[model samples]
Target: MAAIAQERYEDSYLYRLRHSAAHLMAQALTELYPGIKLAIGPPIENGFYYDVDSPVVIREEDLAKIEARMKELSKLDQRIVRMEAPDREAAKKLILEETTLGQGPEVAEYKLLLLEAVPDGETISFYDQQRTDREGKFHRFLDLCRGPHVDSTKEIKHFKLMNLAGAYWRGDAKNKQLTRIYGTAFETKEELETHLHNLEEARKRDHRILGRELGLFMFSPRVGPGLPLWLPKGAVLRDTMVTFLKEEQLKRGYEPVVTPSIASIKLYEKSGHIIAYRDKMFPFMEDEERETYILKPMNCPFHIEIYASQMRSYRDLPVRYAEFGTVHRYEQSGEVTGILRARGFTQDDAHLFVTKDQLIDEFIGVVDLMKTVLDKLGLKDFRARVGTKDPLSDKYVGHDENWVAATEAIEKACQTMGVDYFVSPGDAAFYGPKLDLIIKDALGRDWQMGTVQVDYNLPERFELEYIGEDSKPHRPIMIHRAPFGSLERMIGLLTEQYAGAFPLWLAPVQIAILPIADRHAEYAAELKVRFRDEFKLRVHLDDRRETLGKKIRDTQMQKVPYMVIIGDRDIEQGTVGVRSREEGDLGAMSLDAFIERVKSEL
Candidate 1:
């Protein structure tokens, strides 16, 4: 976790404030709805939420009444206290008697089940809120929970009840559905206001909305959820990215190879992915020959098969294979958030097989390539994370010595690159340790954009070998890397980062030529051809017979990087009125001069 996020979780009082806020909301809901049964309430990222089962439906408008009631309750200065029970029976009694609030033992159904799930030796704790009113009437609210709550409810003043949704109990589909109320609390009013404002801006900049509006990409109901169909503009964006990365890979001496989209199930079994990554994989397919095949969820296994195709000598020890392979994973429908978390996406995948002696340099080379890619993409605000083996996790499948060596290789690579990174345990791939680049987007949200993993297990699993100079068979280290991660995901991030107004070189339609009148249409058409054929620029010509003003408006809305206006004044002098998306109109310039300007940007 980053420092600010870590502090917010462990050190800052906001966590306690948010936790207390959840309890406060629960108390208000209990008072408002007689038959409501509380399940669990916990503080989450940016806010807190409570899940409850209510006999009466709570509409969106009903939230105001609930918030009003919460405000009235907070001012009561209710003292929040935590109490622990000695045994399971004592916890059940507390839940049945006090936590139910005279609504009956049936209301304590979820809490009782929660208590049963707790281990035998663990302490059963509950939070109680009580206050004495002016009439001297004692009022209290209690819930069966393990909590460290704020001393009083007054501290939860700056908070808002954000929204409500239906969530299954414990996230199990078979479990009964409950009403989930989400809210955020802040120490100061300013912070809460700022968060709300940013949320509004985020909604505007949401990639799904902008993706379609900007004619970049779209999701179809017929195509099913999480499957995106790239439109013309979107395809152009993908091609531009591919061209750039392909050239970079070629420069780095990576051999391009194409692999099948579906492979035999045995491939994954040999790679240990069937056991470790079955959940993320699509359903297996059985062919006529009784062979089980699965859609490719990863490209590494295919690359491995290629490397082991032939016996290799020490001179051929370093084999780099690159592929823009499309992978399909079975992401849950609800979990898929547009292209960001899609069921199918392309990976800028590659694997470098090298001798153990070349591991450090190969790792460093991969890291350097990643840095170069990030720099070109203008994603500078990123942090490196060295994902090491978790001491507690048995999920990792590599030998202890191999894990240690691979982990050390990644850390040393980062050190030699002079890039600071934090060690994150359990973030490693099951096969080995990795270096993940977490980039902060324009919205200040962190996205895992790229990764480079040092793997020893996969090579061993495949029994891959190469002849060393000493004439002995030896194992090779594998450096798996993808600087872009995926075309869909990276494009999604870039769309939001630039608000669809991509930089000049990246813009799908680099320039739009608009003719002022019917007489100038030929000139505009000629210019478009010149820009496309001669200069290799993505250009669009507006000859739709629309008014000049309307044409300019449409062009700007499309977020074209540049515009050339041709009219009688420009036609006679052989000059074009040039306008840039960023600088607006740049007066009039000759065609030769315009070409030079465009060359500077490219």
Candidate 2:
């Protein structure tokens, strides 16, 4: 029934238009490049892309030609028709005959290779765009696709071919590279134009671009890929975020702790991560005595060790240990795009060890804390993803009854809180079921930012126990939660979400005092000291020997929240002119009044 609903959703008018645009693109490719071997063409989020093996290397310059052919074909108002082939042999024969006249053996070889991969007992389908119907109408060209496309080429009027790039045949490094062309379509020209505008805006706020422009972070080729170096400005922002969360955690009964960056390989083995997540983890190093050590890929195992440090009773069941732990993982080069997917990052992680009876309440508390953090960060649009076990997979750990209980506890908590969530089968961690928070950025792209996992296997593996009312040893449940999944990723998202204009409290340089001349420098310095000492605000005195306009422009470009312009008149009256990044300049105000405003904002 869910499959049917998905199919119905895909058959919407917009989806069909995008799918038709994909076919038109493939048709244009075959027509322009005669013998282009097609691999796959499927509709994606905004539109569709087709992968092709071309004789000549395709570049951005070739997109215009393909797009022109598409426009000409669309003008013909061709009717798209679908057909079914009884067997692979029949499908191959039809494709070979149609493509042989132009491309011949190369096209036939490609068709045969695809034909051999089709599963048995499944009907092969093709779509064709017909030109005319004078006496007996026939399709000018056709390609294999299992699709629900638009009625005709006319529906693809508001479409465009975006760009081209090299992609692996099947997204695997082992496969041959193919030229992939991306494009987008919409039901109306206005919608397409709006989407393009949004794309342009997104490019401006792209973290990689903003990171460089703002001098926040950088990557060095010598240091290797997927590793970022935070500059002073960036470090200030990171520290501010960490300090805010740490304070919040402390107020909510979390005890701060620190852990080593590397641990013995045996630790991961006991946590079941070495066996389950070996591919994503860094390799172990062999010492002189043959001891193996690994860069910790996660902090849960270390916290588990802390929990089992000594014997505990039911009174200490709800111990919450928090850490700003840095971990390293070996992500594939292709997957390491930016700070969002880095090699080394810090997790705002916490582990709560509780008795069986305290599981639900503790789980609910974690959820509440997650909401509080998100609210403080101005993230109100989010939904929870309840990751459950996949019965067919061997990746899951823990007993079946424990898995059931953990999944039920999370669902009950979500229900009791009246929060909307969706169940995602097979997305659970190896140890147990988890609840992940999915946040949408300013560009409307969804990111999985925070998570809370319920683990029963870890306690059993480590032999964690507590004395209960009956004076018997009982295993405690482990709850793993990270509000900001990783500090690096959170900053990257915030950079784009806020468009590099962070809130005043979080901005690296909250206020810059720009002295109009050298004579006013002393007053500016005094004001900076006053703000920094009293309010603990990040304030800078711009004593550069530059004009007031240039100074103001420089500070504006840096995106400092506020700028105080000190001139002779204001200095004489012991007042300063206030200027804001968002709002224009306000009239002169006393130093105390300005400090009060900063305090209010903070």
Candidate 3:
């Protein structure tokens, strides 16, 4: 489904329009600021951006200037034309001349480098926007790029420069930094306005802001970047999710296992992760004997070692080991975004060892489990994606036959479950194919959460075997599953999904007992204790000396599901004032009635 969406997007006129708009923005930048060496510009998921080494520092205020120039240039109705170069030399000449304008060869620095980086014998192309202004003056802007852009500049009408950020050339930190200008374009004025409005809503629901406001989690620069400190409420939330998943796994006959944070490098080397995941792995550590160890970037290698600890028979064919394992990777400082893309995170990881005959059924079970998790989270807008290995890539492990079988098994399971999915080549893990749940949030943004991968390579790499019905040894296929890809990522998404007002069952504090006055504090405390002991509910007693209205407002801001208020009248009547986050005030209710309400919410 993700692939289809991508294909439709790439094939859409909006894509061409956006791509041309990027070039238009680049043109405006070149006109407004001389000696701006242009880097690559491409249309991305939600918009397009152009990276350039500007002689003058470009700030947020500069976006408006460039955007205004783009608007004026777009009104000129320049004809867009595609041109091809016969050889690398000709391409270099085009970059030094036509693209250089009056800035000389120094300004063509990145363009020349881009041309040289193009593989030998590959077709070289450029896009040229040309038109005669009303004053009969001819104006044109030429850029070195593979072209399928809009036919004219007039098509890039509705666009806005979003912001500016620093981007390293080709995403390499060692390379020179460039200014990246982000912007979005739409097919119609109304659509553009709607998109801008949605951006506003998304800002209001931004997880980083809400994560702190709701007190679910906190990050301290004193510790480090991307390593979050789970506060009391946040810890409870994590425990709630873990406990629920553990119970579900228990019902499904999965055995719980634990692994360490760091492991000997030999383990990953044997599983082929050391090579395939070298870039993401933290720096290797050396022991006295020259033995290498490193922080684990994945849990699969450790689980594989456990599976190989003892010989197995067909009767014990499908062995499922589950763990809420924490792993660390060296994410670039700029790429790390709060907990969503944290360097240290926990994966609700599990590995299933099964025979060839059991592959389809095992895959079906994994998919069903993933679906159950998504459903429980109240995430209905999602699509299944089968990520298969790229045929042209040699970096992938395993034989072609194994890759084909694993891909087919995942597809078959989706078919059996009647779940719609699309195949996305080149997205598979290095060792196997995977099924990803791409969730669409309230703001129409897609997030790739929860993944189930079918692997025939890892077992083969480790030579994991079991005795079959024929009394012969056979390699067992492995299923790598993480219904919540990572607790941090899932919680981040959920925080934004509910806007921090979590469901009653998942909320850190399900109920709050607020005393209307200092005199009523005693009754409120009693009700809180009773609620906790009887229902095992996460209840809090707000016995503060503040005014009743202030306490109620504070509880509401905390997003507690329900609040029980005890005042003189309530204590005298043997009742409590019940107020719900969503339903406002429900007046006075007996303690028994409130318990039923909480139970119903659960």
Predictions in order: lDDT: 0.89, 0.85, 0.89
Model 3 C-alpha lDDT versus the unseen true structure: 0.89
Flag regions of model 2 displaced more than 4 Å: 1-16, 131-137, 171-176, 391-395
Q: What is the TM-score of each candidate against the true structure?
A: 0.94, 0.94, 0.92
Model 1 TM-score (2 dp):
0.94
Error in Å for residue 181 of model 2 = 0.8
> Which 10-residue span in candidate 2 carries the lowest summed lDDT?
1-10
Q: Lowest summed-lDDT stretch of 10 residues in model 3?
A: 1-10
lDDT of 2 by residue, 191-216 (tens): 88988988888898898988887788
Ranking by TM-score: 1, 2, 3
Clashes of 2: 0
